[model samples]
Target: MARAGLTLERLTLEGAELVDEVGTDQACVRRFGVKVASLYLHVKNSQELKTGTAPLALEELADRAADALAGWAGKDALTAFADA
Candidate 1:
């Protein structure tokens, strides 16, 4: 059954978190307390959720890299990126 107050955006975000914690397992739907059909209303399937999350994860990594590289240059920037 669909839970009250659930939204597609929330589902997507939670799905992303789930992926980070447990990988691309479709069985993670059980953690959401909703049927697989319910998830379809928000995402096409587990693969779609995984696909949608990849860009977000990449963007976050890019942001962290940018922050780490800020005000640094040459070997320092290289070192920062490596550490980050």
Candidate 2:
């Protein structure tokens, strides 16, 4: 059962990881009973689950980009961020 206090942000991040590992189609609410129930405690349904995953991926990408760009400059930062 869902703990009731879990936030959508947490679930979204988890869902995104799950999707990346096993593909988004397998990350279905109906396929993951506990995850589905827990996720629904935050999001309305499967579509919203995917919606949540998008921002999580973007945030991760941005964080990686920042880390790659840190302490770097000119072509180095540009190439690192771009390659990342």
Candidate 3:
């Protein structure tokens, strides 16, 4: 059965943390606190998680930049984004 709250986003974030903590080779479903064979439905292995985290990281950075630049424009926005 599918876990009640399991989703790609949570898995991606978890994978990112796992990779950061233990490196990609060690970032497996064990971190989910279960055997988690079902995790294969979302990702085949750690390499997929590593690749998946890239887009998540990019999106987060984009969102933060947008938020930080929400009130600025032109050179000010560029500077804020650079500083961000």
Candidate 4:
């Protein structure tokens, strides 16, 4: 059985973390503490995990940028968005 609380979303988040820690090439189940077989249940391979993480990162970026741009305009909004 899959480990308690283990899910694809968790794995994807961990995988993104691994990318930040090690690099995309090293993002894997073992790096994040999971069995290869278990990871396969959610992702076809490490590449798929990496692909899945891209959207997560993009969403987070969009959220931060939106928050930064809130209540601002013109140069101020541009600066905030860029900083975000």
CA lDDT, every model vs. true structure:
0.75, 0.73, 0.75, 0.79
- Global Cα lDDT for candidate 2: 0.73
TM-score of each model, paired residue for residue = 0.71, 0.61, 0.55, 0.68
Tell me which of candidates 2 and 4 scores higher on TM-score.
4
Candidate 4 or 3, higher lDDT: 4
Candidate 2: count of backbone clashes, pairs at least 3 residues apart or interchain: 0
- Residues 1-84, model 1: lDDT tens digits: 556766666666776787778775465467777777776776667677777677788897899999999999999999999888
Best by lDDT: 4
Task: Give the alpha carbon lDDT tens digit for every residue of 1-84 in model 2.
Answer: 565546667667767888878887346454445554565666787777788788778998999999999999999999999977
Q: Pick by TM-score: which candidate is best?
A: 1
**Which regions of candidate 2 deviate over 4 angstroms?**
1-11, 28-43
RMSD of 4: 2.8
**Model 1 regions lying over 4 Å from their true place:** 1-3, 25-27
- State the lDDT of candidate 3 residue by residue for 1-84, as single tens digits: 776676777888888777668876345568765555778666677567778788877887899898889899999999999877
Candidate that beats the other on TM-score, 1 or 2, i.e. the better one: 1
Single out the weakest 10-residue window by summed lDDT for candidate 2: 25-34
Order candidates by TM-score, high to low. 1, 4, 2, 3
On the 0 to 100 scale, the lDDT of residue 16 in model 1 is 76
